[model samples]
Target chain A: MKIAVDAMGGDFAPRAIVEGVLLAASELPSDAQIVLIGREDSIREIFKEHNFESSVVEVVHAEEVIEMGEHPTKALSQKPNSSIGVGFKLLKEKAIDIFCSAGNTGAMHVGALFSIKAIEGILRPAIAGYVPQLDGSIAIMLDIGANADCKPEVLAQFGEIGSLYAQYTFQIERPRVALMNIGEEEQKGSLVAQATYPHLKANKRIHFIGNIEGKDLFTNKADVIVTDGFTGNILFKLGESLYEITKQRGIQDDFIDKTNYESIGGSPIIGVNGNVMIAHGISSPTAIKNMIGWAYKQVQANAYLHIAQALA
Target chain B: MKIAVDAMGGDFAPRAIVEGVLLAASELPSDAQIVLIGREDSIREIFKEHNFESSVVEVVHAEEVIEMGEHPTKALSQKPNSSIGVGFKLLKEKAIDIFCSAGNTGAMHVGALFSIKAIEGILRPAIAGYVPQLDGSIAIMLDIGANADCKPEVLAQFGEIGSLYAQYTFQIERPRVALMNIGEEEQKGSLVAQATYPHLKANKRIHFIGNIEGKDLFTNKADVIVTDGFTGNILFKLGESLYEITKQRGIQDDFIDKTNYESIGGSPIIGVNGNVMIAHGISSPTAIKNMIGWAYKQVQANAYLHIAQALA
Candidate 1:
C-alpha cells in the first residue's frame, strides 16, 4: 500500500512537508511505502540537503500548486497538475492507499465530495476532530464544519459514522454517543436538536447517551458527541483557541497538554470513498510527520472499508 | 429607583442573595432602594446571624419557591407568590427599576417574555453575554440560548439592540456589529448566517461588519457579535469551560483572568421591557454583588428605554 503526501499544500510546504514525510518515513514499518506528490525539483533538492538522497520514498512530480486561498472546485479542475489535484488523481487510480494535505481546507473537502466521492448509501461524509477528555482517553466528534446545515436524518447518521470511528480509530468498543446541546434534557435546545433526539436514541449501531452540555465537553460521560457542522465548528475552534491560551500563558497540565493539535496529527474526512487526512495550514514539521504516521495507521485499520460497509 | 432581588433563587439562596444585596446596598446611592423578595422570615434570620439586623433593608414576603429544575412557564404560573414571580410583578407595576436572580435560566427567559413582554416591534427578547477581549475591553454577544430559532429579520434587529447595548452599557460609540458564522466569507456558513448577512448589511441602525469566525471570539474584530441562540449558547458554555481550565492550571494572565464568570458578574437579558441580569447558578457572593452593580449602571444608562425607542 502507498500513502501520498501533498507536499505543496500547507503554508510551510516543501520544507516542512518534506522533512515531516522523511521523519515519518524513518519511523514507519519497513514494508510501508511513502509517495511524495508535488514539485519534484524542490523536494529532491531538500532531500539531498538533508543527506537522505538515497531515501526509498517515491516522488511524483506535479507541475503546479494550489494557493491556500484558491476556490476548491475551480482550482481542482483548472490546475489539474496542482499537487492537491494530482494527489486526488493518484488516490482515485488506486496508486495510493490514502492522501494527506495541510493545504486548502475547502479544496480537501471538495476533493472528498467530487474527486473520489462519498461511501455508497452515506447521506454525507463528515469531518472528525479529536476532543481531549479529563481522563487519559480522548473523544472524537464529527461533522465539524462539513455540511454546516444538517437535517435530522443527517445528524442521526453522524452517530453511526462517529461510532465506527470510535471502534476502529480510537479502539473504543460500543462507543457511547451523545448529542451536543445547550441542556442535558432531550427536549432542550434548537428545533433541529429536539427533532434529532429520538432518531439518535433509536439508532441500533451505537449506544446513545442523552444530551451533553458544554460543561460535559471534557468529561468521560460520553465517548462520541455528535452535532451539525455549524455548532461543531464553533466548539472545535473554541477548543483550539483554549489550547493556544494555555500555551501562550506557559501553563502546563496533563489534561490540557493533550488538547494540542500537533499531538493529534490531523482531522479525517470520513465516509469518503478513499481515506484522507487534512492537517492544519500552519502545521510544523512534527505535525506533518504525525499526520503521515496516523494516515498509515488508518490505512492499516482500513477505515474506509468499515465505513462503506456500515453505511451500505 | 428600587432594585428587586429574588432571595429564594440560585443554588446558595437566601444567604448568598441577602449578602450580595447588602454588599450592593452599602455602596449604592442613598436614594436607591433594594427590595428583598422571598420568605421574609429566613432572610431576616440570616441577617441576624450575619449581625446585619440593624441594616435598613426592605423585605417583601413571598409565599412559594420555585426549584431550579421546575418548568419555566409552569413554575411562573403555579407559583405566583414565588420570589421570581413577585419580582417580575414589582417590575411590571413600576415598583422596581431592575430585578436580578441567579435562578433557573429558562424561568428567567419565560418571565421576560410573558411577565413584562418585549419592547414594541421586537421579534423576540434575547439574552446577552459579555465576551472578554484580548485588549482588556469586552464585546457583547446576544441571543445566547434565549430563542432557539430566529428569522433573519430578528437577527438583524439583534445587531441594532446589541449596538445600543455597546454604546450605552459598554460605552463604545457606533459599535461594529458582526454575524457569527462557520467561515469568514459572506457566502459561507449555515442558512441562517447566509440569510442574516444581507439583512444586517441593509439595516440602517447598526454599523454592520461582515462575517466573523470562531477564532475572532477574543479578538478586536467586532464589538457586538450576533448569532442564533443555539450557536451562541454553545460558545458561551465553552468559554466557561476554558476559564475553568485556566483556573485549574493556575495560569495567571491578566486577560485570561478576566474570562472568569465571577468577575464579569452576570449576563443581561436584553430586548426586554425592563432591566434584568441573570447570574451564574452557583454564583459566589462576589458575583452576585457585581451583578447588582452592573444592573445599577444599566439603570443609569436606561438601556431598556433606549432599546424601546430605537425599535419604535
Candidate 2:
C-alpha cells in the first residue's frame, strides 16, 4: 500500500513532515511505501540531513504552494501543482491509498468536497473530533465544522456515518449514537433538534440513545454524538480552549493531558469517497507521525468500505 | 428596594435559600427589604435556626411547590400557589422590585415570559451568560438558551440589549460588540451568520467589531458576543462543564476559580420588564447569596430602564 502526504502544509512544513514520514516509514509494514508530495528539492534536502535511504521514500514534486490564508476553493483551482492539489490527484488515481495534510483546514475540506467528493448518497461529508470521556474512554463527535446549517435528514445521516467511524476506528460494538440537544427529553431542543429526534429514533443502522446535552459531552453517556457544524464547532473549540486554560494555570492531571490536540494529531474526514485526513496546522513531528499511523489503521480496517455499505 | 426571594426553590430549598437571604439582608442597604415567598412555616423555622431578626424578613404563604423535574410551563400555570408563582405575582404587582429562584431553569424562563412579559419593541428577550476571560475580566454573551432560532433582526436587537447591560452593569465605556461566527472574515459563517453580519454592522446602536470565531471565545477580542440561542447554550454548558471537569481533576488555579459558577451566582435575565435572576439548580447557600446580590446590583443600576430606552 502507498500513502501520499502533503509535505508543504502545516506550520512546521518540509522539515517536520520529512522527519515524521521517516519515522512512520521505518515502523510501517515492509510492503508499505511513503510518497512525499511537495517541493522536491526542499524535501530531499531534509531527508539528506538525516542521511536516510532515498529508495525507501518517493518524492513527487509540487511546484505551487497554497498559503494557509488563501481561499480554499480558489487556491486549489489556481494551483494544480500545489502539494494539496497534487495529493488529491494521486489519491483519485489509486496511486496512493491515503492522502493526509496538516495544512489549511478550509483547503482540505474544499478538496474533499469537490475533488474526491462525498460517498455516494451522502448529503455532506462530516469532520469528527476526539472527545476524551471521564471514564478513560474516548467518544467520536461529528460535523464539528462542516454543514453548519443542517436539516433533520442530514443529522440522521450523520448518525450512521458517526457510528460507522466509531465501530471501525475504535472497535466499539454497536456504538451508542446520540444527538446533541439542550435536553435529554425527546420533546426538548430547538425546532431542528425536535424534528431530528424521530429520524434518529427510527434509524436502525446505529444504536440510537436519544438526546445528550452539553454537560454529557465528556461523559460515558454515548459513544457517538451527532450535531450540526455550528454547535459542534463551538463546543469543539470551547473544549479545546478549556484544556488550554487548565494548562496555562499549571494544573497537572492525566485527564487534562488527553485534552491536548497534539495527542490526537488529526481527524478523519469520513463519508468522503476516498481516504482523507486533516491534522492541526500547528502539528509537530510527533503529531504528524501519529496522523500517518492513524491513516494506516483506517486503510487496514477498510473503514471507507464499511461506511459505503452502511449507507448503501 | 424590596426583593422577593423564592425561599422554596433550589436544591437546598427553604434552608439554604433562607440562610442566603439573611446574608444578603444584613449586607444590603438600610432601605432594602426581603420578602421570602414560600411555605410560611418552613421559612420561619430556618430564620429561627439562625436566631435572625424576623422584622427584616417577611414571609408570604405559598402552599404548592414546583418540583425540579416537572414540566416548566405546565408546572408554573398549574401551581399558582407555588413559590415561583407567588414571586411572579408580586413582581407583576410592583410589590417587589426583583424576583429570583434557583429551583428550575425552564420554570424561571416560562414565568418571566408569561408574567412580566418582554419589554415592548424588543424582538425577543435574551438571556446572557458571563464568560471568564483569561485576563481576569468578564465578557457578557447573549441568547445563551433563549431564541434558539433567531432571525437577523433579532440578533441586531440582542446586540443593543447586551451593550446596555455591559455599560451600566460592568461600567465598560463603549463596550465593543462582536458577532459570533465560524470565521473572523465578514463573509464567513453559515447563512444565518451571513445575514446577521450586515444587521449587526449596520446597527448604529452598538459598537460592532465584525466577527469572532470559537477560538476567540475567552480572548479579549470582544466584550459583548452575540449568537443564536442553540449555539450559545451549547457553548455555555460546555464551558460550565469544563469548570466541573477541571475541578474534578483537583486542579487548583486562580483562573479555574473564575470558571466556578458560584462566583457569579446567577445570570440576570436581560430584556425583561422587571429584574429577574436564575441560579444553578444545585446551587449551595453561597451561590444563592451571590444570586440575590447580583439582582440587587441590577435593580440599583436600573438595567431594565436602560435597555428599554436603548430599544426605543
lDDT at B170, model 2: 81
Q: Write the per-residue lDDT of candidate 2 for residues A1-312, one digit (tens) a residue.
A: 787889999998978888888887887777678889999999989888888885658999999889889999999999988999999988888899989899888899999888888889898888888888889988888888877889999988889988988888888989999999877889878899999999999877789999998888997899989998888877777766656766776676788777777667778888988888888888888888877877887777667788888778
**Candidate 2 Cα deviation (angstroms), residue A261:** 1.7
Error of 1 at A217 (Å): 2.1
DockQ value for model 1: 0.68
Q: What CAPRI-style quality would you assign to candidate 2?
A: medium
What local lDDT score does residue A265 receive in model 2, on the 0 to 100 scale?
72
- Evaluated on chain B only, what are the TM-scores of all the candidate structures, in order? 0.96, 0.94
TM-score of each: 0.95, 0.95
Weakest 10 consecutive residues of candidate 1 chain B by summed lDDT: B48-57
TM-score of chain A of each: 0.96, 0.94
Best by DockQ: 1
The structural similarity of chain B in model 1 to the true chain B, as TM-score, is: 0.96
